[model samples]
Target: MDQVALLQISSALLLNVGFIWLVGSWFARRWLGSSGVKRNDVEPALRKLDLVAAGVSAVASVVALYAATAVMGGISLQEAGPMFWMMLSTTHYGHIGCLTILAMMILFAIRVRGGTSGASDTASLLTIVAFAITRASMGHAGENGILSVSLAAEVVHFFSIGLWTGAVIVSAYFVLTPQRVATLALAVTDRYLNVMSRGVMLAVILIIGTGLYNAWHRIGTVEQLTRSSYGLTLLVKIALVACAIGLGGYNKFFGLPAAGRSARGVAVVRRVLQIESVLLLGALAAAAILTSQQPPTAI
Candidate 1:
């Protein structure tokens, strides 16, 4: 609950929220539009939300950079100010942080200029992907070198988390409003949920695969999992993720089919999604804490 930890959590949450909004918006427009609702009906609101998320994420990135510089140099914030330019110009972490900020700015610009074209959506998606990649690269993954398996596993793991948990966050809070649910045809709702379920299944698979690799690579032993702060936070994260996955499985197996049958069913699915999103956010907060700790393996 210190400043650095708070900033890390804020930055992680904001970055993922921005990524989710844009990606979810694209999915909704692309698939839901086939059900007779024009994309224009939702595009403006979604775009506005995307822009807001990007703006907050950009600001958080700047603040995080200052904090990281202070920590890296073992200096006070005021003292760190003098070293900030040097770090920004000289370090790999600083370079990735700059790229993350740049990507956020590009996303802001793309949304601000506002067109409903496929090209614009594609550009926005690419920018967000770049932002995710740079953010991942700035983590412990980067310590292993750009081409190492550690970095590759971490990048894949990060994307899987976003696709699974982040998607649910957007769906529960933004995309699946009661009004919007009522407007969407049963078939449309079913199709969207089916597609999402499939995507979530895929994400879960990748998450499990890469998560095991990351856990093994970082913690190294059963003793570490119980003994180290990093491992303990990671245990909490894994528990949260496991609960979220259980909820997701229920939705995929039961919720989607039920949703196809009635409006009430769709509402039930949304409620479950809301709960799942909360669990995922808790896991994300644990991850932020993990990042601030030294791994037992490193010790």
Candidate 2:
């Protein structure tokens, strides 16, 4: 991919980390709220995750703002600042996105300082959803004739991906840390696995359905699959997705039930989750490449 493509892709992946943080933190608190574990235990874990997530989100917003200008203006990133400022001051979409970023920064501050409430969390969630929606509206989803339907499908796809990846991220934090032994009690971990199993299954279905719907319209025909770069990259992405799904299915069916039975078992599951994350990252990169290239119909 070219530098601009790389910037867009990187910005997208980085942006995802923000959404994932919200999902992860929310789940950790909600799931453990009723457990015997002290609320102190659960809340602290979330805040720790929040500190890292806030930093990531802040950096990503800055990068995306710069990258958006570069991509749209077809200018070197360093030269895109003036254009970025102009859009921030003039365009509806640009201003809205910037405002969301500003709000999220404030929310992140409250989160890090341990002052976040359900209301703040809800606001942040909505802001991220808005951000994701704006992204969809400006991209391939809104390009075709099915603007309304495509936009809805894109929302489902992005949120589903965010939810699934977010849970995995939290799991990684708890499982891979040196303090795993104390991070969450065994019962709590088991409950988390149970919830994740159901949540991820639903997300997978949504992601697959919306992905195919979008692709059918964009790819247009089987002949184009072999004739265009977009189609080829999409095929590769599909393979990567299948790999990720297979790994997740294995974890859900075979590994999860066995998790927390022993320290060794938990460690094994942790390793599997980390690998699944890597597979997803590969898929995300392929998706970015596919997005940057023209669709087969256009090609």
Spell out the clash pairs found in candidate 2: none
Writing each residue's lDDT as its tens digit, candidate 2 over 90-169 gives 87657655755775576577676674477866766676676567656656775543348988998788778777777676
- Could you give me the TM-score of model 1 versus the true structure? 0.94
* Candidate 2, number of clashes: 0
For model 1, which pairs clash?
Answer: none
Alpha-carbon TM-score of each model against the true structure: 0.94, 0.86
After superposition, candidate 2 runs with Cα above 4 Å error:
34-36, 143-147, 175-178, 182-184
After superposition, which runs of candidate 1 have C-alpha atoms over 4 Å from their true positions?
34-36
lDDT of each: 0.81, 0.72
Least accurate 10 contiguous residues by lDDT in model 1: 17-26
Report the Cα RMSD per candidate.
Answer: 1.7, 2.8
Q: Candidate 2: TM-score?
A: 0.86
C-alpha root-mean-square deviation, candidate 2: 2.8
